[model samples]
Target: MEYPTIEQLHTKLINKEITVADLVAEYVDRAKASDLNAFREIFADTDIAAQVAVAEAMFQQGTATVLTGMPIALKDNILFGGHVVSGSSKMLEHYTASYDATVVAKMKEAGAVIIGRTNMDEFAMGSSTENSAYGPTKNPHDTSKVPGGSSGGSAAAVAAGLCVAAFGSDTGGSIRQPAAFTGIVGLLPTYGSVSRHGLMAMGSSLDVIGPMTHTVGDAKIFYDAFKGKDSYDGTSQEQSIAVSLKKKLAMPKFDKGGIDPEVLSNFEMIVEGLKKEGFTIDEIELPHFADALAVYYILMPAEVSSNLARLDGIRYGDRAESVSINDVYGDTRGALFGPETRRRILVGTYVLSHGYYDAYYNKAVALRATIRKELEQALETYDAILTPTTPTPAFGIGEKVNDPVSMYLSDLFTVPANIAHHPALSVPSGKSAAGLPVGVQFIGARFGEETLFALGKIVEDIR
Candidate 1:
């Protein structure tokens, strides 16, 4: 049985053309076949069976929701009750979540089956999935190349058709970059659009949970279900109630300056295709966009260092039994954290160190504020800012492992969205010369996801 999209599968369920059990079984089999090292653990058959039964019941009662019976992969950082929620780190490998994250509960209510936990960069630190304790998830398009990380597994699972869609967290382009590499659509909602109650803290101020799917329409379906206010998360805000996709259709066009020529050409073709279908286009610019990456690195590592400090062995997480408390903390962290994790911790610690705080961390914060202001001003003139998801396609494994700075640069085109707390999506633009996927991103203002989705759909139709 070939993989059917979420829309097709949902239509079949509504029409009684396929049973929930049969659909799940087919996806489970495909997941087993590809494996791809995408998942750290697949849900037990009993779990899937129970969920399918619920979906079937919902259908029978004419109470089906937007995602009824759809199988969806989750990044290990997002907690699901009674499931191991290791953030791809050895420290919490045996930790099982005792409660469902608010997002997980929302997904279940919408009728999505929690398929399995996908692998990721350990503690969501690395740019490549190689840092995962379970090993790197191979890209479905080219096994030798990376799937991009720390949301690599989530992207790979969706691209490989193991699941119609998946959830991934982005602190700094983890969702969008991988989606670009895999030829899928990935969204990063506004900073507080989706509740973060159940997601493990990497960089608390920056982490966001979003959907990755085969199409913009599918992403919007999942987004609508999980976004909005939640009592469990104080940071979550009510969505802009008056906003509609209709308003987004009137957005002006934008030029692709400072982007790769090939990427620009592909984007033009997408624009042309959309214009033929009655969509509008205009040229706009976001000044200070080029400095987004520098600001991100400065802010993210500082936040990461602070958040990860809670993982000291004596605290709530995994601990090492040997030596004194200090030794225990050192040994446990040294043993549990991947090299990338340790590097960030060190960089973060230095940035926040007594005398350097004003020079490093504080400076970075000032830059962050400036960048946010620049983005806000840009959005006043343009509905969305567009760019290629990554400067280049996926590269081979070990190609960037030794050079941390080079790996960080891979997210050059993606960091600005995170910096501004704006919504962004990576939609498939086309395949590269090597037959690898390429993604073009659409960025919008804070709480401007409807605009991103509206424009994303236009691109989706063209692609």
Candidate 2:
């Protein structure tokens, strides 16, 4: 059965058409019976009863919000007090969060019932959920294909109707890519617009938490509920800009060799459709744009190495017994950290090493600033930059697992937004000939979420 959207469900609850318990019970049963492997754990009714009661009271007191009683899921990397959040890694398999993530707290304040923590790539280090310590999350569209990662579990949960909405963190396209692969909407808010406190850090400068949903409107509702300045996150700040559309969208000219023919065809069709809707499509030249993936690889892994260093066995998670402290650290990480996590750590450490810092890391840093400036300059005239979210639709599971470079390329178009600290949204453009979903992304200027939302809705409606 297709589940009601957040707003639709809200109306039903307000009209007494259904109770919160009934809704939660239905989704819980479905989640339990599913074989998608989308969730790490579904909170027992006993664990959720208090929130249900709180939501029920909010309605009774006429203080309910759109999210009240909505059964939502959080990506495993997000912290929810009293729940185990392992970041889909064996290293933290038994680790419990002592406090809530800021976004989790916001959702609770809005009377949302967080249903469970979904699976992901171990330590948010892979492009496919196959890297998860538990298991890969299969795409809801086809059991044989991957849903995309490290937010694959959350993407699958929402796509499979296991929950009304799910929250996922994006560090180099984790959220958007999976959302595209699963035929849903994903938003990557401007970096630092959403608090990162309690989110297991992968790349601190590149990470932002956002919502995955079936509709653009739902994404906006979820974003509004949680985004703002945070005392817990020094990098967080509130967005106050009022964005009005300029009716102009910029499409970058780039090599099409790597992109699937069908995907490019679908995108061209979307561009033509928008032109018919009276929006101007400008082919703009952003020279540094083509270097996004290269820059992201260097900068993100560098941040990953630094942020993940704190996860030493002694401080937080599973530890290997050894006679020496060095052996303990070495053995624990080697045994518990997945291959993708280890690979990134090694690459990160290499680039940040004293002898190579100026050669690799510093050059990438300089190039990053150039790319950001190019994007900012383009957005000064264009409302948003548009592109297909991924080069192709969901590939078969394990297809790219052994080919790490191919997997990294999965984030091609989406990484530029993170590199530039701009907001980007992925909306289902249409389905491929094989019936897989193809997503179109809109990259807006910083604090231009409203512009992206407006553009995303148009893509959603046209589809």
Maximum-lDDT candidate: 2
Look at candidate 1 and give me any clashing residue pairs. 252-282, 253-281, 253-282, 253-283, 254-282, 254-283
For all candidates, the clash counts are 6, 0
lDDT of 1 by residue, 1-463 (tens): 2356677888998988988888888777888888589888889999999998888898999999869899888899999998899999988988899899998998888778888999999988777799898889999988999999989999999888888889999999999999998888899999999999989998888899999888888888888888888898888998653245432222223334545666666766776776687655565445567677887887898899889888887755688877787899899999988889999999998888999999987887888888788777767656667677887788898899989988998888788889889888899889877888888888787888877877787777678
Decoy 1 TM-score against native: 0.93
Give RMSD to native, each candidate: 2.8, 0.9
Give the alpha-carbon lDDT of every model: 0.84, 0.92
Off by over 4 Å in 2: none
lDDT, model 1, position 113: 86
The C-alpha stretches of model 1 lying farther than 4 A from their native spots are 1-3, 241-261, 271-287
Q: 343-417 in candidate 2: lDDT tens per residue?
A: 999999999999999988999999999999999999999999999999989999889999899899989899999
Candidate 2: global Cα-lDDT?
A: 0.92
In model 2, the worst 10-residue window by lDDT is 1-10
